[model samples]
Target: MNPLQKRCLILGASTRAAAQSALYAGYHPVCADLFADTDLCTIAERLPLQNYPDNLVEQATSISPISWMYTGALENSPEIIQAISKHHVLWGNNAEVVQAVRNPQKLYQVLKKHDLTALHLREFNHPPPANSRWMLKPKRSAGGREVTVWNREAESYYAESHNKDKLSTDYYFQQRAEGKNYSALYLASATQTVLIGLSAQLVGCHWLNADNFTWCGNVAPVLFSHQPEKHQKLAIQAEKAGNVIAKEFGLRGLFGIDFILETPFLPSSFPQLFPLEVNPRYVASVELFERAFDVSLLKWHIAACESFEQSQQEEFVTTENYSANFSAKAIQGKAILYANCTFTFPLTIERMPNCADIPSYGRLIQKNEPICTVFATGKTIESCQKDLQERSDEIYDALKIKE
Candidate 1:
């Protein structure tokens, strides 16, 4: 380690990009996460975490005296964030803000007061509407991992699992909204916020063989309509809602808001956008924004939280210009490659283009295990989707393991 280089520790379910971003900002990144992929290992010091929150404090203490930041699932566990704060400097929101935004009832009330549309949610005690699909979402969770449709038949099934306790208090049923999923990413300081980018979320992709509501990836610079005017209006609406949430919650650093666009074609229609929840932390779509906009939101995220002397803040451009630029430029997307069946890691990969999150060689991957991430870009969303599909197909073919 260079004596002069600042050291930063990144903790999350996956810290690959956070580590990379730290390095980009000239900091030595130390990472602890579930998968210590080869690419991540190449650039940063990797610490394999057996169990989170329980073991995080000990592991973090082992590498003491370094500032830390969390990426994905850790944001959902404010207690863990608080524990880490006792030993290290946290580079993002404090535990209080995390707790505030994660409280579904409070969040819903706040957003509702601001006229932001959100799904009708209720505690588990409330009976679900008959014949209507409702999703059971775990509080303090991310990556859509245990989120599933609610039903009486699944009660016994859940009762048998270790998550039975979580069902009591940390879970609730939400009325599902019909629409295309979207997310608004932004950077915030104490006083103001800036819209970083927008993404069309990839949910439950058939090619990925993921469950319904499972987050696959994102396509940045989302086009809501063919007409440029409506597209800008939709962007403005989403951004306005995001800014309100950020300011209302006093959210600082890089945060993302998940939403559903019920009417993508008719952007001018009332209640076209319904915000689902606020992820007051670094999200999966940050990588997509960095790729599409040729900007480093992560760098600014750190700067926004800390008192770093950053040169030239990221400009907040007009929504019209933002939408027009996205329409004119290329569209980029990423796909999380999941294993269809249990198999040993391949000794060699063939022509696997734009792949990331690679598991270690000789490691056995179980069914539905996320093997890696694949990325692609093109002139349009459809073409980008096709390109990413092709790349994913090439990887599966090379692996040659059927579902």
Candidate 2:
């Protein structure tokens, strides 16, 4: 079979990055996503998801006979996965695995029973203590949408202010854990799981108009050469917890573990790390891995899925093997610039490297909508962050959106 004829269908909220990676891996990508932006259209034939989960299979069939992979929001609905798997080769985690990890209550119970690092979580049936700081998280949501503080001042008015029945099972509360945010990315086969890379997740950058927990981007190699031993220990702990979760849930292909180190960078006392949630799909950080190691992550992801099915791990390269090839060439980061107010794209769009999810010209962008994605790569984290800020400024300035 000709490799170019191996059509890979990609679906997600926005599949530009994955589509790009698929092209790099020598596959003909047929994409169905929310934003068929200019960049994505340049790479693959666009298929419209006319009715979403219901139309997913039909839309895919409309394109060609091909294997499919999904991104962010699709994992929340396992029924959709099952439905799609009936017709197409699904290249990621299946319905059963998604069910195990997507349920917050079940995941919390597993973490507590296994003696893994975890935060204090409570059911929404009862109100949290009036004095304690708590966060209300949707049972099934992503990219930090709708995550907010459970304000004590509004405690008494909870029942009167909202629907009680919907609150019980739709959401839960957790005592806010203070710490430095990080994510551990890994690959899993049926027999074993491999830790791939660690990254510092960028959340709530004010410049991007993102909320406190809204995911912005990531910087790979969380622990640089000069970091202390304690930081390295944290990374190891993350891997240990990741391995446990992958085995527990039978997670296959690409997965990420969100974590928090309970203290600042240095001068810490009694630092504890807590594992947050298990993201059982390809995350934003995969791009960072591809940039740092000069390898196609999407190809590895597809390969991992195939390898897991055969129960053979020999075909896959270990994370350590990839790490050995890593050099201190440059640090890379990607930031999503969100709109603070309504605006329209300028007449002339400036071309930028790694920029994606671009809004079309003359289109009205709403408040809080993502304007576009910008990227930066440098010899140091500081330099990379600086570059991101400058590029973001340029984007906002061109669109006439203010802070």
Candidate 3:
């Protein structure tokens, strides 16, 4: 694939993160998923869309797809990926490496070999005992879905829901690991690496339903900064784990890692960081940044996918200080990022009336979706968050910001 001639397509671009990265990277970057017009597509405006005929993995992976598709879960997407070979064409990770992290039982053993602590887990084809508390997960899945607490009447229930939807016997049962989860989006090549962005908190927990699938938003970096040193340590561990998996798959592009920060066995000490799994693609954080920064992430990714390295010849640009925020769930159900990037806003402001009167303190003026991602790198996170909220409150309520 000639570096200049190659292109990229990203799966799991439902969120703004992947779209932002691809767009900024300079590729209109194709967006593929079951959900159309997701946040990713709205902002991308022109990213191509692809729908599969059940065998999409084979189709999507059979080429030099610019930057690798950052679809969330590939292991569980077996039907889509049943045709994986020794290597794939379009930019992406090695399928085998993805399978390894998907199997809960296998993952636990792998963790032990790698000197990492993981949840106490097991797999049972038959129903579980009442006192037996194990969290069951699809052998390969993502986004914290179908995870259930230990159940005793497992057999009858299992028979009823066995082949329902994407569920299969290939599923595994384990202890419901509990702890705070976070995401760190990373981009890497054989020789180069960069931590592009990080997300606040992860949602996908279950309490009473025994099955939890929801975005538990707003664990922003602002809140985590209360314990800065500890948070940094965990981020390091997560990046390392993702790197190991990327290396294993012989990967060479953008991806993400999921982790659990929990109290160590030694109670008095700070929480011990543990690497949970790898995403092998772009994540929501980057998508949020794309809108907040108004830079195309896809451009950089495409450059890398085509060349297998960032351009030393051409210069790169980034904001002095910016954020991909979406934490106003307390006030609004969804999130929209309002930011000032190297482009957009100020240039378009003169086009709209009363735009100057509104709080354009560098707040992004575009608001059209469920989540609002904002960027404000003032002296303090509190101040940034406050400014973002004021602008968000005004925009969220105004008819002009409406779709």
Q: Which model is ahead, 1 or 3, in terms of TM-score? A: 1
What lDDT is reached at residue 126 by model 2? Answer: 76
The Cα error of candidate 3 at residue 112, in Å, is 1.3
Residue-wise C-alpha lDDT for candidate 1, range 1-403, written one tens digit per residue: 6677788998888889778777767788899888888889988987767875578878988876767889888877788889889889878888999989888888888877888777788897674753447778888667777887776666655667785665677788788777788888887875567776678888888788677778888888776457777677777887788788888788988888888878545655654778777888888887777667665666677767876432333343333223334433468898887888899988666235588888888989998778889999887788888888888888888899745
Q: What is the TM-score of each candidate against the true structure?
A: 0.89, 0.92, 0.62
Candidate 2 TM-score, C-alpha based: 0.92
What clash pairs does model 2 have? none
Name model 2 segments beyond 4 Å from true: 1-5, 51-54, 153-157, 161-166, 264-270, 307-312, 315-325, 350-354
lDDT tens digits by residue: candidate 3, 146-191:
5566565554465575535333566766554456666666666555
The most accurate candidate by TM-score is 2
Candidate 1 overall lDDT versus native: 0.77
Evaluation by lDDT, superior candidate among 2 and 3: 2
Ranking by lDDT: 1, 2, 3
For candidate 1, the 10 contiguous residues with the lowest summed lDDT are 314-323
Task: Write one digit per residue (lDDT tens) for candidate 2, span 162-191.
Answer: 655557677888778877778888877666
